[model samples]
Target: MKKIAIGFGVLTGFLAFTAVAFAQTYTPLAPLPIGEGGTTPDTYTLSSYLVGAIKLLVAAGGAIAVLMLIIRGTQYVAAGINPSAKSDAKERIMGALIGLTLVLTSYLILNSIDPRLVEFNLTLPPVGQSPAAAATPVAPTPSAPAPVLNNGGTNPSAQPVAPAAAAPVTITSPTTAVTPLQNIINARINRSNDYSVISNCMGNTTYDLCVKTDLNGDGQTNLSDIVLFTQKGNLFDVNQNRVIELANTTAAASCFFKMPGANVHAMLPRENWNQSWSDGGSSAWYISGYSCGGSGGITGMPTVACSGATWIKAPALMNKCAITNGYMNMPFGFVYGGGSQFSKFQNWVTSSSVGSAVDLRTLFKATFFRPIASGDGIPQDEYFETDDGKLTYATIAEYDLNNDGTADFNASGADMTAFSACQGGSASGACARADFNQDGTIDARDLNLVKLMRNDVFGGSGFTPLGWILNWFESAFFDPAGYSDTQIISYCIGHAAFERCGYADVNGDHKIDNADLTAFNTGAPLLDFNSDGKVDLR
Candidate 1:
């Protein structure tokens, strides 16, 4: 009876200790200030409290069992003449063992069922702030319904439809379908006053595909220009095979154009002028046996060359090539003859041609031919390719509103501010900046588009190209500034709400509840648990 009474007292003390520990409010050593309001006090969830109680119970039970064993061993030795005392000591030892086993067994069972049962979250965020605000200890809430996606993973509504046979090119006067190509051209054209020469071609409504070939200065892009362009092997085919390979490569391909210009050059598999004569000669040109230096050829002309090739001007060949390949004509003023042939092409079209006489920068656009369905029908002309090389409508409609040379989600407040400025506004030319669907208006539709792409990371993990550029420009060229802890917390809270990240909605069902504790422990690191800028549990 004495031993049983001792054991009960020990258990009661342990229970009291656990109760006190749980009831005590958590206090941070240095609490972070949130926004302009309150300090984010350290907080704990009910689940954490329960977990603490369980731990204390186990520790107390184990300690008592050890103490009982020691006492029984001592009593057994001392009670040499008293059998009753020996029996009592043995009973106490057995009881202690049984009780200890039960406590440990309960812990093991609960832990095995779910590690979260034993998990305790000590990190807490400030309350009553935006989704971007510091994280706070929140009880799990009810989960929301699963989000609906079109066509399982594919966006069928955004899929490009096949062009009708011999369909007349729709010509809306003064403007055409605001395509990715058009946007790129317009951006380049507006970047400099030197590009004024080609500004008239900005809104041309002649060809479904913009054509810049007026080789003879006839001011008309006829079939003759296309023939000349093809003859020069300038309109190279985009290697659909390479793009498909990239699509399967990884998520990075969805945003960055990884294929080198050389690979782009290799995309033209057919025998064309782009290829060297030694590999596979062009059928259009006959190789003459006579060398330019031999007898009948001119002093500077090549002896062994394509027949009648000298009759066509070099500028005409380049212009025709650009047009044939579904790009705008390369202006004569653009520097051409240095570096890798592909590099020269990129420079001539977009970068180096800035100060040149005739700037056709606005006319340059990438053309891709992607199949809509598997192994059926003709491949449709896709104007833009996503970083992953997918031919979806989202990829096509994506634009570089910030003019940072890459299209990606706007994650900063500055970007949001810019977007807000154009909302409910007239169809100013600036409309193209935020008008996602090119409907000539910036409204709810465009806002929703921004929301849809908020999580999109371009250039893959560890290397955010656009973000890096923006940061560099801000620090190096513009004003340098850093967000304070309060600002960071506020931004985090706002970001969570905007993205529907659900730090409190642990189950990801879009609600908070006790059930969510299970998900919170096991779920992906989608929230910033440690006040770091990144979304991670650690």
Candidate 2:
């Protein structure tokens, strides 16, 4: 096995060298020689990235401090310098403390220390892919639903479909999607690609996929376009038989001769490939042997059970002689053998439609008995995806449902999105109130018929309607700046309705009133650590 891997490496290296000799355009996913050009991007400025993060922290903190100062100064001026002023001073201190609370609270919620803190599992896109576009019919006409491809392992990537005799080169963007698959397909592709330039070409599987956005919509990276191939693979004729047959489906031939631009009706899991893919589509290109035992350790073949942080397209698998460059971002190495070709599933995506009326289904589950993760099987440790032009990252923490010790969040459920709305909103946000947009104030503008009943103003008006009071305040004294949560609670001090009598124990020292004032004055490290009018740290 050792000699075979070496020989295969040398042979593969020569073939790769020959292929590179041709001056062909490659996409962003273009693969490079193993020991050659591919490298982790040095574009991330270690120093500059850190500097920018520090700057954002300073800016957010500074804004909160300024607000606190304004609030404190306002109260001090309102009270004369006598005992009243001293009392007012204490009030100002509390106000500052509250402002600090908001600032530090927001920071704690948004800070994420690590990205790969979550675990991921080897996942494959089902054979199900977007159906042929109506604008272009695959094949001369519409061919019958293709059979489950015989590729070694079943992939739910591209559904089998035939483009018209001449299909126009229409596509989608990773950030913008006319169809959902376009989004998922493109997002995964863009991240998998380690190349510099992005192109859409057929042949080189490495950089074959491309992502485009703002296609007939506002320019955004929300769409995706998949590249079929722009590279070569060594596994086309698995059995060394020139004729690609059904029986050789699980062998390297499946990846090599897997039909392009068609939807498949079956799937092959990686476990069924019988460890043949290790042979590199072609045994000639495949590595001979490695120390693969009960643990399945084979030198030349891809570690069938190795987990890769990145995900690659199946069509991509077919491009290599018997090498894989990326993974599905999981902790466990998922295996697919001969009978598990993923090419079996059919994908149907629907745009301009919603609800049960329109169903986007994957047919692979129906054709084969795939042991899809029983319950969120993909380990979900935690992953980070930056938005806002990559300026900010959405901290996602995944929980491993299957306690095989693999803790990653690969499954999606309704509960998964429960905290989604709060992902960006602050405690001061409009959520949980009439303030749906999070601008701050709960007003008639947010909801045309909004009515806030200031129970204090109701006095003796029989039964004061809730909205009636809210409506009066907005029309009479409502001001955007006045809607600050800190201000609202402060105002409630003298009011009868919103009582904080016992709640005054902000310091949790178990005391009620005066101690709360002392705690506010001291500006404990938790709430007012930095205390420049407001606070940070805690």
Candidate 3:
């Protein structure tokens, strides 16, 4: 009966302790740290079970000690009359009190250290992850945008600020482009081994072995020498390799002064005909598979006789001015112009008696006007009969501007709309002048081509391909006789003041006005490309 009473009392004390613990407010425990001390699931589990067992043993021991104390006290009270019994009960009571004290003291120490130290917490790291790795939060990896490839299509690295508007500077082969002026500077300053001398000594000037080396005939020995060398002279094969590349600026700049005789130039190595010099710097003789200076088979340098006036073949004419100058000085007040001038010049040349005196057949000789008698499907030379029934010759060289030998100019069904656009100062002299692509028609591409080239000249990021420039050159000025390549560089440099540098200035009047407006009408709905609207002349 006494044991049962002790047990009931111990259970009541335990319930009271639990109630007190529940009533007290405490800070919510932080989440259990799983990775510390190299703790593994198996170890944590074993520890958890062992700690729980120890806590249970301690609690059971404390309860047992309390029960024993209660029994010992009851025995002491009941042993009032007997001295021996009372003494024994006192000793028992002392032993029970000591055991109870020890158990309570141990529990207090553990609770004081950390209540959680006695709790069962055995959380494992995520599956397939280490505890330390799982403890840290991982961030998502970022991806990069794709690169813009170099196909002359898009320039991803182009500067936001546009490069200054300048004359066309590149000399292109089939697959590469080199700036002549820049190349010359690099060759001379760097003394690169890629170049070799092509000319012999006539007289010593600034250059070591050559005479009359003042390329521009400018007394000072300066960078202009490199530029004028290409302007005034043509490149030829010095090694007789039949494969001619660019001439060295150092040699050519000096040798170009004593032309025909001092035919020296700097030679850049080229492996094949495709890389050879095909731009205006090449001589007509060399281009025709003959000798430079008309030696080999062509005698006395075949010259075209325009009336009594004799002009050198197409290759000799440096620019549009030199090309057109042979026929007549541009009417005294005449200015720089574009493809629209084809009809204007034709009209002036045919109507004017001075122009009438010159033979029209000799002046215009492009294959477009006069296809090759053999393979060029159209055998008869294209001509324009004037209002007075006078036959005026017209033709443009079959220009494969993009190096695609297949001619882009289709003659059979040419764009009459494009032809009509060129009509202003004269009757329909040649309608195809507005056909910028020579696909035998004028469309949005042609209009956009003009806008791009025009914007390019005005310091915009409208990178018109060099091929497009060459194509436009054939359409303009209408004298199929002269070369437009090298001349175009000089023309743009000299005519920049007049705004005639871009292909957009249609009438060569130094402005983009009415003449240029024709293409915009036919090619597209009127667009304010730069969005300046009516005020934006460009």
Candidate 4:
């Protein structure tokens, strides 16, 4: 009965130990990939476990040695001078010590072979015996937001343990964009290794290597020179590989001046094209191949403006200051103008007349104009006719002033209707109406009318020719075959002004009317653009 009881106890203990071993989970933690302090945690854990086990064994051995020494002394005290018996006793002591030493040496050898084995640590129970202190749980930290893998969508370390049970997951970080301009600038500046000299440019002044110098040589820093400097007067390559410095004269963060005409626009790095504009001006440099216009369309045509009146009595009125001469930041693109000239505005697109290979379709995709406050919601970006009260009219037929396939500037049936609003409000300071009476006369009446026109304070439209000045000749002018607005205005105002005699009345038709109007209108035989009706360019 005693033997059976002992056997049952041993069986129970063995079963309990087996159950505990089976219940404990051992999850395999993989090593981190290409990271800092990877193996340190694992090594520290293993070292501590080994040190503890070794100390436990040393304590047990010390206890056993003390017990043996006590038993040996008792046996010796009981022995009656038996030398052989003493030798046996000493041998047992030595044998027990040798066994302990062998166990320690064996343990050390095993640890050296597999240091990781030492990490099998047995945690001691907490001192307080409190539930919280006894098992201070270590909550696993949530892994970092998975990084985007760079290896073509494959992660280097995270391999599936069960190939059939789990699918491979890939994570990657977003790619940063590239700047090609800096590359080009570097290459261009390296003249010793690449091309010869920068064409038309003299030398660098902190910003560019080649540039034209104004007489003052102050760099005459303007948009035109900036373009010429960067393109080297070539107009073909505008991608900036080099940095244009930020100086007092020109301090823009970026001034990428690629000619958006043909191949240049396409070959350039950035994908989208940009533009901008203001009241009487736009900065959307002309782009070719935009879907907005197909072949045979006026895709590259100049900007058409509203000349408020037809000064049939005097045809020199033009919009001089209304156009912007400086640049403005527009949500859509850019608007540059504030300094050029009166009546001298034109779009800054690539001169398609020069024929280009650059694909600027993205830029020409659209064009926009900001709304004018006075227009009640009417966008101020279309063909503007002179207010009829001002005698102005549109020179170009309305097609796509908005450049979005819509007729934003229709002058078709709008002939004189647009001029009614400004019949007498000729903003033009140019002398156009003084040739009212058919004779040459600057009488008090004509001076009074001109003075009123100048101040724009108040006026009436009913001056039938009696109260105005006459031109030295007859009639007004028109545009030439190939001349642009700037060309025409420059030629006329220079040598075309008659002496200040408001009423010369050279052709005395007596009434300051048609006869006087004829004098202002008379051309020198074959007269042209000027209302003076003269053909003298020399």
Measured by TM-score, the strongest candidate is 1
Global lDDT of each candidate: 0.35, 0.27, 0.33, 0.28
> What is the C-alpha local distance difference test score of candidate 1?
0.35
> If the candidates were sorted by their TM-score against the true structure, best first, what order would they fall in?
1, 3, 4, 2
The reply for model 1, stretches above 4 Å from the true place, is 1-26, 29-53, 120-538
Tell me how candidate 3 scores on lDDT. 0.33
Maximum-lDDT candidate: 1
lDDT of 4 at 348: 17
All candidates: TM-score: 0.19, 0.15, 0.17, 0.16
Local error of candidate 1 at residue 536 (angstroms): 30
Give model 3's TM-score versus the native structure. 0.17
* Model 1 lDDT per residue over 486-515, tens place: 222222221121121133333345433344
Worst 10 residues of 4 by lDDT: 251-260
Rank the models by lDDT, top first: 1, 3, 4, 2
lDDT string, candidate 2, 415-488, tens digits: 22332343345434323322322234333333221111112111222332222221122222222232322332
The local lDDT score (0 to 100) that residue 351 gets in candidate 2 is 19
Worst 10 residues of 3 by lDDT: 251-260
Error of 2 at 55 (Å): 29
Tens digits of lDDT, candidate 4, 1-538: 3433464476458435533342222323763221112232322332243345455665675577668767876776666688888777776666656655654665576554333233333333435454333333222223533334777553322332334355544333112111232233334443331122222122223224333232224654333443343333121111122211111121111111111112211111221233456677844433333332222312221222211211110122222111111111111111244332111111211211011111112112211112246432322222222211111111111111222222111123121223223244442232222222211221222223223222221123332222111121111111122332222222222112332212223243332233332333331111121223212121
Q: How many residue pairs clash in each candidate?
A: 39, 104, 13, 83
> What lDDT does model 2 reach?
0.27
